[model samples]
Target chain A: MLGTTFKRIIRAGVVGFFRNAFVSLATMLVMMITLFVIGSLLFMNAALESTLDQVKDKVDINAYFLTTASEEQVLEVKTAVEHLPEVMAVQYISREEALVIFKERHKDDQLTLQALEELDENPLGASLAIRAKDPSQYEIVADFLEGQMAVAEGEQQIIEKVNYHQNKVVIDRLSGLTASIETAGLAFTIFLTVASVMIIFNTIRLAIYTNRDEIEVMQLVGASNWFVRGPYIVEGVLYGFVAGLFTLFLFYPLSIYMSSATESFFGSFNSLVFYTSNFGMLFKYIVGSGVVLGAVSSFLAVRRYLGV
Target chain B: MSDSLIRFDKVSKFYNGGPAALDAVDLDVKHGEFVSIVGHSGAGKSTLLKMILAELYPSEGAVLIDMDDTQHLSKGEVTQLRRKIGTVFQNFRLIDSKTVYENIAFALEVAGMGDEEIEVDVPHVLGLVDLHDKAEHFPKELSGGEQQRVAIARAIVIQPSLLIADEPTGNLDPINTYEVVQILKKINDLGTTVVLTTHNKGVVDSVGGRVVTMDAGKIVRDDSGGQYML
Candidate 1:
């Protein structure tokens, strides 16, 4: 009986949907627009998150050491820095080596010659380029460098200076922007989704209002609530299903374009591959969520306006 | 005949801020009987029919169908009871989106009748209301009388034990009204109980039956052979 009820309702719903082609078409169009915009936003936000993560991976701290620091002391400091556990890689550059590389690389430029000659000696200190396992731990390396005392005979610093301050501000701003985008993206997604539901609900309500005579007659003739509600709920499900599939269709090409455009920056952006690779999972979530939302909107609208 | 196919046990229905729609109403409807409920508007004739169908539960008393108290029936069970009792409305509430055939088949579908049964039964019911040719016509395509006839076909399609028509002729012309009453009498002759509420005196006087007259939500008269008078 339950199975028959299900089949009957589905049949009636489909028939009812076709009976009022204009309203059903209007509902589908509304759903499509709403779902498409939301899907686009989701795709863009995910891409932004991916690119920001890659950018975060590239931020590092460059610490310049005192010029007079001995190679052995510097090696000891390097070993200690490595042992700090946050440090991923440490490259030690000597002052002479730094000068030689600078002169060799910029021999064609007069500014290079003037800047090198003004130093009077190898004014460049041995610098340790420090990369941490995590970008948030850049300050750990900075504080460690500033705290070293005996490397240069207590000249108020074992290192000349760290150039990461300006870079740090940029990275921090970038990170903050990314965080804000993520927060705003989430908020926008929620707000837009709710608005979409409201639109669909009011559309269904109008549809129901137009057919309220039928609803009241159904009630008068002793139709159950399920019987009365079944067709509209099915209408909502159809609206949602078509909308969701339309959204998927719109997302497909956009995801491809997004992936290709971002491939240069983030190495073959394969979100389409990733999202589609899990076809069963992703499709389940999308269709299930769409149908459920549509059905809920219909159920709520009918209950409020045309209770049996 | 059974004493009553429907019985009201001191049924009273109170609205939110006004006097009760039905004030300590006691009523009886016997099997194969055609009872006309006549009253001035707002005199609770509609409320009485609504109670029989269990649309509105009595505020202070109980209503019984076939001697079974309706108060304890679940919502689903009330629906089942309603399937046995058909209702026609003043507005001729035919589904606008559906064709006349679909509207008539709806009642049989509600009863979960087989399609084969519906195929055989729906056309017969429509023919009984003389609307068999307009099966493919939508409600909007039909005239008010034709729409009311579609409503009548829907009510009778399930072969319900009782039929309740509230101002069924309210929207019809004199000819259509006479035709509608003739159809109701035809259904009653087939041994189905018919309870009709109307203010049309000519209808009541022509199709002489039991008459229950009401005034101020109270039953003022009951006669086996009655007229439309308080």
Candidate 2:
């Protein structure tokens, strides 16, 4: 008995979905737009964060060591800085490497290259470049490095200078900009989801209104509430399921089409690659939200309008 | 235990504190009886039928279907009570999206009948209506008479203990009306208590059983042998 009731409701819903083709299509189209907007936000966030990462990569504290400091002393300082929770990485450029880099940078300036080659010995110090996970936490890494510089290493004063102060202003501004963008994106996504849910609810209410007589007839005939309401819920789920799948398909071509532009604009963040790689997560969200929105809106609309 | 399929005890139904839709009325419909309710518009024929269906509760007094008080039945109880009684309206009220066969099958489906039973019962009812050829056809494809017959088929397919026809033939022509009335008589003969409300004297005369006359929300007269009195 339970099995037959369930099958009948599902069949009725499937029949209703196809029989009312115009309304069903209109519903699916609107839901697709909602899912598409949400999916686009996911891609946009990826691109934005990647661009921010590029900016974060450019600003790090560089500590120059004294020329007399041995490689072992500098290596010890590198390991200590790497142990800091906030520090992402530390790179050591030896005196020879630093001199080579300086010469390469000034190769276009013949006078500077001559000046560099005329030195009695390489005056450049070995340096450590320290990067922090969060641009805002660069200050803590800087303070830690300063404390290391003060240790004196047996009164030799091996650390000559640290350049965090010069880069502090730029890092702080970058951090603030990224933070504001993320907060704003979250708020905008929330607002869009609420609006889409309202639109779906109203659209379904109209569908129920059109079927009001059928609903009344069903009720008057003594169909159990679930029997009367079940078909509508099934139709709602189908609307969401199909729309979610279609929206996913819609993104495939769109992601591929825009992959080149996004890659060039966001500097190696490809939309197509992100879409395929994250397809499982995206399906869970887009399809899941679609089903949730469709079923919930229909459920609520029938409750409010049908009163059954 | 009164052998009454429906018993309305001192029922008074007034809407918005205005004049009563049904005013302090009492009536009984016995088991296996074909009773036709005849009255002009506003005579409370519709309201009284609605009471039996539990669509409306009495403002005063009580309505009992098989000794179960309608006004006190919970929502699920109301539904269970409704399933025992089939209702047909002036409008055919067929789900247009469904075929004629599906329309009849829908009644049994809601009753939780198995598919094998539904498959057999739907075709039997379609054959009785002589719409076996039109089973796959949509309601819109059928004539007015055919649609009314389909409505009757849907109502009776559930084998409801009591069938209420509220102006079931209101939309049909003479030929279709005769066809529908004949079908109702056939269903009543098969032992399902039938309560029908109509404005047609021809329908009352044709039923040829019991007629209850109402005026201004009161039963003015009731007679056996289905005499139509206006």
Candidate 3:
């Protein structure tokens, strides 16, 4: 009997799906588009973060010490600033060494050599070149130095302006854009989920409407409401499952292809791997979500319109 | 010897505070008898039939099918009770989506009959309706009379103890109507109680069975060998 019921549900679902072919196709197209948009947005956000991290790896801030500062005081400040947890690295450059390095790098540049020869003495200060764990945290380190005891007093006085300003606005905009993308993606996902369900519900409701006469007949004949409704409910679930499978077939390949593109372009980014290599896992998630959406919407519509 | 298979004792049915659809109606249908309910439209024939099926609960008093008060039965049990009685509608109500074979087979399927039994029984019922050759045809492809027969096939397929047909031949011509009434009589002779509600006065006279007449939600007459008197 269970097997028979299964066959009947499958037969009915197939016929029902094909009976409303245009509408069913429209529903599938809408669902696929929604899933693709949301999926791509998530992938893009991840890629954006990965690319920003790569660029941030190249920039760092330098802190110079006063000639009057004791070596012990500079060492203490270095230790304290390093202990603040945001500092990635601090390389101390002495005044003579800083000047020698600058001259060596600029030796072939006639304009810079001429400028340096005009100076009687090297004006470059002894500095600590500091790399931060995140460029966004550079302000935090700078604030610690100016407000807290993280930097020694004489060294703090000798320190020139922090150079995180150029990247700060760009970093802030990226952060805001990431957040907005995530928020819009979340809202769009929810809206699309609801819309997909409503479409399925309306579709099933049409199927039910076409059979209202038969249902009324069944009811009159003392066929229990279950006897009347069981087949259609089974039919609804079948629609859900087929839609889910179709959704998986479409999105999983798209995910794989997009991930391949990301791999070629970005060179082994974690976001690409996280999004693409987990295609099967995400497909299962989507299929589960689609099935649940289809079934629940169908159930609600059946209960309300069919009233079975 | 009319041993009542169904009894309605002072049954009153009202709809949402309006006037009663069936008011203080007292009636009975005996076992192995073919009873036809005839009156003008709005004479409460359908409402009275619906009460027997427990589709509508009586606002007051009791409805008894085989001495069991249907008023107290839960909805689930009402369904079980309904399985014991078969109903046919004026529209034939054959499931158009199904073939003639499936239309007959569905009743037994819902009743949990084994597939082998359904396969055996569906053909037998279709043969009884004389539509075995058209078993693969959908309801829309059949004539009005054929569709009504399919409806009968589905109802009688379960062999219910009571068959309630509301306007079974409402859309049929005189010949087709006669055919359907003959089928109902034949099923009645097989010991199933038949409760038929119709507006066809000619059918009531020709069937020569008990006639229950109603007017404004009240039974005006119920007599053996009765005619279609209002």
* TM-score per model over all chains: 0.83, 0.94, 0.81
Best-to-worst order by lDDT is 2, 1, 3
lDDT of 2 by residue, A80-126 (tens): 99999999989999999998999888889999888877989999999
- Lowest-lDDT window of 10 residues in candidate 3 chain A? A147-156
Docking class of 3: medium
Which residue pairs collide, candidate 1?
A: none
- lDDT digits (tens) for residues A1-308 of candidate 1: 56766777888899988877888888777777776666655555656767767776678777777777777767777888888978888888877788888888888999979977886678767878888866667788778876774345544455677876868887678667767877988898888878876776777777777777678778777777888899889988987887788767666776677666666656634667655765565456456656877898888878865653
Q: For model 3 chain B, give the 10-residue run with minimal summed lDDT.
A: B103-112
> Across the candidates, what are chain A's individual TM-scores?
0.71, 0.93, 0.62
Which scores better on DockQ, 1 or 3?
Answer: 1
| Candidate 1 residue lDDT tens string, B1-230 | 25678888798888995898999988878888899999999999988887887778899989889988888888888889989987888898878877899888778777777778889998898878888889999998988888888888898888889999999999899999999999999999998899999989999998899999998889999999887785
- TM-score of model 2's chain A, to 2 decimals? 0.93
Highest-scoring model, DockQ: 2
Query: Which candidate number would show the highest lDDT if scored against the true structure?
Result: 2
| Span of 10 residues, lowest total lDDT, candidate 1 chain B | B1-10
Superior by TM-score: candidate 1 or candidate 2? 2
In model 2, the runs with Cα more than 4 Å from the true position are: A151-156
Where in model 3 is the C-alpha error above 4 Å? A1-139, A147-177, A221-230, A237-278, B1-3
- Of 1 and 3, the candidate ranking higher by TM-score: 1
